[model samples]
Target: MRISRLRFPVLLAAVSASLTLHAEQTDLRVSPPGWWAGMASPKLQLMVHGPDIAGSTVSVNDSEFVIEQVNSLDSPNYLFIDIDIADISPGDYELTFTKQGKEIYKTIYTFRPRAANSAERQGFTQKDTIYLVTPDRFANGDESNDSVAGFVDKADRQAPGGRHGGDIQGMINHLDYIASTGFTQIWSMPLLENAMDDHSYHGYAITDYYRIDPRYGSNALYRQFSQQADEKGVGVIMDMVLNHIGSNHPWMKDKPAKDWIHHNGEFSATTHRRESLHDPHGVEADQKAFSDGWFVPSMPDLNQQNPYLTNYLIQNAIWWVEYANLSGIRVDTYSYSDKAFLSQWTARLTSEYPNLNIVGEEWTTNPVITAYWQEDSYRADGYDSSLPSVMDFPLQDTLVNALKDEETWGTGLVSLYNLLAGDFIYGDPYNLVIFGDNHDMSRIYTQLDESYALWDMAMTFLLTARGIPQIYYGTEILMANPDTDDHGVIRSDFPGGWKNDSIDAFAQQGLSPKQTKAYNRIKSLLSLRKEHPVVTQGKFTHFAPAEGIYVYFRTDEAGKGAMIILNKNEAENDVQLARFEPVLKEFSTASRWGNSNKISVKNASIEVAPKSASVWLLQ
Candidate 1:
């Protein structure tokens, strides 16, 4: 019924010419699209696609199997082979491709079965406290690999944006410290190879998609980190970048095609007008500027519109997920790529892992703009999406505004009040990733003007509020980077993490009094969060801010409730508790974390200290 695209006469002539050359024939180049260790069927369906190699047979070990599927058939490039297994086992086996009876190509495949009950089986949800860390700046466990081959930059702790010798072994050593801090998930910046001359330590500009940087560790070491993190009750979330590749990437040396990167020969900088993406009155020039512009000449924007490039990117992500056994993926600069390609990528990933979560970085200060990228939100333009979560930029913007302004008509705590009220704009409000400060901004301590009380109030609101809260590393020890937004200052070396480092915040050795108090206060919150299930999984309810005081509560059906009160005024203020009575339904008493006796909130007004926050457990 179908005409063959390949003419038999031409094909036979080419084969005859090849034989006349007297060249030795070799095996077909076949690769699986992607694979995972565990599956309900304990079987794999590989989508094998390559050049002309018809009548080729597939076999696992010595047994032969037939290809069950042939997709894109008129041209017919793909063949799907499925394998079945009864019980899960761990070992290596070879898969072979043969023609008639002789072998053409053979590749070894490994299946490592996990225990019947593995800690990695746990999935991410609305209930998690995520800690974001930059491994290069977090700590240095092995200094031997600081100066690596093929990388232009060397270890220079003094350089504001240089590598600092942090590796997989460093994180491994701190497993107990991370677990003890009450963080359920740890999301590290990309550890892939970025062999550029400047700012490569940040790990955003990727040189190689498949290999881990030797400076960080080997692929095997990364797998060990995942396994160890799982045992320590901490989930690992990988930072993935699909929009761009390092300029020095090998592909740039000899591109697969001229269309591999956008505006391949022409280099232009982006206008950084993110609003142009959704701007109704925006021009084509604006859209082009946002989409085609270079982030930096070193970070060449990849053209996802190219089918070959899209396949490569998608397969790369799937490979990392299966290889590292990653729990989740945090996509960087999510909106910069082709929208259609993004939908396809998201759909394919979710199709493979139904319940797995993928959070995107939609850095819009407006709720509507950010909400448009979420999974189920309706779009006027009718764009189908498979994205699940987005960073809460509206909340971050409001928190910054509220800290700088006094109580005005629509300002101060009112900014925060109105932001939370706009949760209706989002499809899944609880799935948003909320944070006070991250690697991009100044440290939380610096944002609060180095004021301990303001910092405490910020932490209280972040922890007690809804959505998944992410804490930046070193915030607990009051790391400060004032005046200069130098990333190295914001990402200061962890105290006592290295051998020669005299200052030890972990054991409180040689720390200032203020640093000691801040460390202890943060540690207390970490411990408290673990014991309170309501904080992890609960509905949020906020009360009006009056006289420099704001109140909120997190409650669940299990009768668990925690009250958070923040006072930002210079003087002490008494907050009326009657308004929150409805949430205190069956509770007869309330106890402060450090205090013993139950306090009465029925008809009393509580006096909160100036610029401080207090959390109470209602019984």
Candidate 2:
């Protein structure tokens, strides 16, 4: 059970009276710089940090808001104040710290009113095509921030794992390129501060939750980027890491409690066996080893069971969503954190913004394991995850393997068919986020062994298939990491993102015929998808794979429909139109998508290009 806030004031009052005799003037800091009033959750925990500040008698100058409790942890430098801001209006209020009845220090905190209908802002949905980017490698619009004064890692384009100087300004500069590419949402890798000595370009090892990486840009710049992206009809999905923090995080040096981190100040790597969470016969030791272990020696796993720490993390997530006006969030390691804490965290955020969408990374290829974390899932343990969405790793793996393997028995496309048939395991199949490849995985072009035909098939399935689709940066131009799966090479610099690059993908200059075709194909499909609501909000029907061909259809309530056919043969195959008579009964003509040519249904057969995926509109 969690400790009660009612007992905190009495305990802290005694400590404050004793420390007042030796109190001295000092600096004070509060996290979540400020908050807004009238939030769904009336409670707000302010983490006050300063030298010997925990024992100070804390009080708010305003009478509208009540200071429910003041908590002092094992560390003398931190104080947790729980305040009820339910009935308070938006305004400035002074937080005064008195020691022995003498005023020691005072600081002003602001509570801004929320934007009109801010809670009703829509989150990313199936209609959105998300483009994932690694900001450091995407572009460098601000050279000044490439190597900040205090940053440990500087710009080094030659080093694949080193910072390449991409900043928020670079993303802002290319908003038009993104919007024109048919991507409605941009899910950039973590842009939070990662003040590490090396390999910080990925932004996974977060050192500061509130501060944006100076090398990337300031916090205000990121907020501005989100606003500008919104103006261009694009939403921003922030990537966040909740499982661990960089070793250099301030908490590592000055921990508030002994159990703030797992392993009790010692390093014990996680078993990486994510299955332990749902394993029926799983032993207690294995579950503990998996969740309590550190991700790496450099990244410390946070212990979420600590109520103070839990509240801090929950507040931090809400702070970002409110401050940046984010459309969605992509949690880095979803199952690695404490399961109960995840429920609380997601529930609080959802309660605040009912329409917000959050997609968690489970990284498991098993449908059962991945689906277990979604909200309203059926499980033996009866765990109700409040998560709205999860990465479709199971479908992703099946899609890739099916496209690569030959059509033999229950192999190849049959595997994909079976996987889609298993969609019943998910509470909401459309809420799952589907992607061909991400920053962590090999590029789709490379995954398909650089075959343009296979690439086209994969993209067609991704865009037309149910659920939200996320395309990695440079996928439009067929970026490949053929040599190795090195993080640096996979997240390569965009051709036109920098100043001196001869090839500018944005301008469509100096691109090969194959690259141009791939780019145009994606653009056309995305444009069509944006115009067709049936693809985003329609009922799905699929025919089992046969003779190296797979067929599927998406139809809406109004009778509008789309048919997609995937042929894996090297020679053009004649598809008998009679087999699809059930769906094509009312239509007389079939026209290929992205083309004006129409063929009469009287022909009884349609010629499908070899080694290609095709979509047709029946009218």
TM-scores for candidates 1 onward, in order: 0.85, 0.95
lDDT string for model 1 (1-619, tens) is 1112334355445544544533223322334423434544343455454443344676663222223432332222334455654342444445555666865454444455444533234446666788898898777777888878767799887787888888888888888888887787889999998888878888998997777889998888998998899898888888999988888886676555577788873567877787787787888789778977878888888888876567667767766776777778899999988888999889877765676678999887888889999988867767888888898878877886787687777678877987898888778888888988888889888987898888887777777787888889888878889899977778877787777788976567989888888877777777777788787677888887776678888888888888888887889887777878888765766788656746876876777788888988987
What lDDT does model 1 reach?
Answer: 0.75
TM-score of 1: 0.85
Put down candidate 2 lDDT per residue, 264-318, tens digits, no spaces. 8678999999989899998988998999999888999999999988888888998
- For residue 506, give model 1's deviation from the true position in Å: 3.4
Q: List lDDT for all candidates, in order.
A: 0.75, 0.88
Q: How displaced is residue 418 in candidate 2, in Å? A: 0.6
Per the 3 Å backbone cut-off, how many clashing residue pairs does candidate 1 have?
A: 0
What's the C-alpha lDDT at position 419 in model 1?
85
Report the Cα RMSD per candidate. Answer: 7.5, 5.3
**Root-mean-square deviation of Cα positions for candidate 1 versus the true structure, in angstroms:** 7.5
